[model samples]
Target: MTITGRCYCGELTYCIESEPIMKGNCHCRECQYFSGGHPNAFLVMSDSTFQYTKGKPKTFTRSDLEKPRTREFCGNCGTHICTKSEFRPGAIVLKAGTLDDMSLFDKPDMAIFTIDKQPFHHLDADVPSYERMKP
Candidate 1:
């Protein structure tokens, strides 16, 4: 299936031509901070499937952590597009909220980093929860 998405300012747009390999909700501290303090829905697609159809996205790499993650966003609107990390090579993590059609992807298969998840935030009981990350 093909997936299309763009940043808020429309400066950055991308298309994933292959089916995603993973889908999840992340509640890591970094995710919370980046998403303005809430879990972020994500779809992990093969790097080969991703293509930047519009302006190139600006990236900021987080080096302070054990596994440095790279966040790619639109320079104009500051809308985060995706994240990359050594933990999952040859893959790109799409911020589900940026998707042009939310239903384009399947429901999250899991919820990760529940240890740092906000207690007030409700989670899907049907999806398995991981204290840190799914192994």
Candidate 2:
């Protein structure tokens, strides 16, 4: 199934040509920062199936981290689009908020990095939770 999405400003857009391999919520500290103090909902898909359909995204990777995931965002709107990591090679994590049809992401299959989860972060009781990255 093909999925389409764009940034808040519509400056950067993308198309996903395949169904997501995994749907999950990340409560990592970094994700909290990116999502404005909440867990980040995302879908993992084959990198080959994802591509930009519009303007290029500005990328950022923390040099301080030994293993840093690269975040791609709209340079104009600063809307984080997707993330790439060497640890999860061949997969790309797309932010759920960027989806043109948000309904497609009804629920997360799992929640990761719960160690950093705050009391205010509401996690679905039915969803599996991990203290750290799923391994």
Candidate 3:
């Protein structure tokens, strides 16, 4: 089944031709900074199944180091969209909140970067959390 999403302003949209590899929440310092001080929930899918169906987005690279990941966002409204990480080849990280019909997706199976999770954010005991990225 196809999955679709759009940026907050609806300027940037995308389509995923297949199911995601995984869904998770990231509380990494980088994610908190980019997501306005909170964890970012997203779907991890293959690049082969991803497509841009609407306006172009501006990209921001995280880390100048060897494995820099790129984030794509709506240029018009500055809405966060997706990410591409060299660390995880063949995968495209898509922001969950941007989904056109969020009900179709399941709850995140993992919570990454728990070491940096804010004190106020209480994670469920059963949500499988990791101090760093999911293994």
The local lDDT score (0 to 100) that residue 62 gets in candidate 3 is 54
lDDT of 1 by residue, 54-77 (tens): 999899986677778899999999
Task: Give candidate 1 regions above 4 Å deviation.
Answer: none
lDDT of 3 at 2: 90
Query: Which sequence of candidate numbers ranks them by TM-score, best first?
Result: 2, 1, 3
Rank candidates by lDDT, best first: 2, 1, 3
Q: Which candidate ranks first by TM-score, i.e. highest? A: 2
* Residue 9 C-alpha lDDT in model 2: 99
Q: Which runs in model 2 stand beyond 4 Å of their true positions? A: none
Candidate 3: tens digits of C-alpha lDDT, residues 1-135: 799989888888998887888898898998888789989888888889688899888999855578788889999988888888878898888888899989755788989999998997778788999999767
Worst 10 residues of 2 by lDDT: 43-52
lDDT of 2 at 44: 92
Query: Residue 73 CA error for candidate 3 (Å)?
Result: 0.7
Clashes in model 1: which pairs? none
Question: What's the lDDT for residue 31 in model 3?
Answer: 87
